[model samples]
Target: MSPALDVRRPALAHAPLLADPVAAALQAWVHADGVGVAAIDPDLADTAAFVEAYGVASDASANCVVVGGRRDGVERIAACVVLATTRADVNGIVRRALDVRKASFLPMDRAVELTGMEYGGITPIGLPADWLLLVDEAVTLAGRVIVGSGLRRSKIEVPGADLARLPRATVVPGLGRPVG
Candidate 1:
């Protein structure tokens, strides 16, 4: 295992299990389209947990990343991609690629308002039309993967190969190693 992955969010076993919005949004898509879908609830946000969430032997899960960028002097929000075992280097890749002066995580309220998904569930599937999406090469390697449901209560497992079918999504290698 990569040492980078070793520094993951520890599972608070006693902490109440919570809902995931990303999961819910993905499930909704599955039902509307009748696509085979499943949800992987992890006890923690660590790499190991995510790997377990997708039922992959290793880091096979895709990442549903959120980013905050300032465009035209206004703060805008976007989501990016990376392998679940990897992380989003938002400060470097997101900011430079988007040409934004300042980039940070979108505030909870703003993230919810823009994505129409509840906090913790933001997904790129039905994101704002103008919102920029930078899909990673690693994500496309997998036929299918799990992402945020736009709600913390659930997650959306979908076909990664067919992501471009959605309008206004640009597939690129914006995914990078996290600077955290």
Candidate 2:
């Protein structure tokens, strides 16, 4: 755990997402699932900034990127988790896994609206039920990791293996490639 970071229960945060029925349900689900939540300054919610400010190792921080594509004129979305040291293979691995021809990051507005989570605070725990959740194999091997808590003001820390066990989550090898 990052030093000086305050870990709290989701219900105590009073985050906007917790007020929404869907997000609230997801919050409860994560708690019951045994994930720990840590509150931080909203301004430092972005991965790089948070790591720099809080001394969290980048390799132990997971980033969740929302991707969108279409098949048969219907939109398909997925939430992909990868270590901050790597980039999700959105154009290749993720595209192939999702069975979509062209895949790109979901537009911010749509992602935020659909997940009911802040842009920099989306996690695999409470995503849309129908959307795919892909966890990079490396993430699951990293032991404990820091991830978003559905609110920019907080984050979740859990064993990587636990994230891989989220409902609808699939562990994909090479889902993320090392950053140059």
Off by over 4 Å in 2: 1-3, 8-33
Candidate lDDT values, in order: 0.56, 0.82
Question: How do the residues 18-135 of candidate 2 rate in per-residue lDDT, one tens digit apiece?
Answer: 3253355555565434555666888999999999888989999999999989899998888999999999999998898778899999889988999877889888877888999999
What lDDT is obtained when candidate 1 is compared to the true structure? Answer: 0.56
lDDT of 1 by residue, 14-56 (tens): 1122233323433444332422333334333344555554345
What TM-score does candidate 2 get on C-alpha atoms?
Answer: 0.88
Q: Which candidate comes out best when scored by lDDT?
A: 2
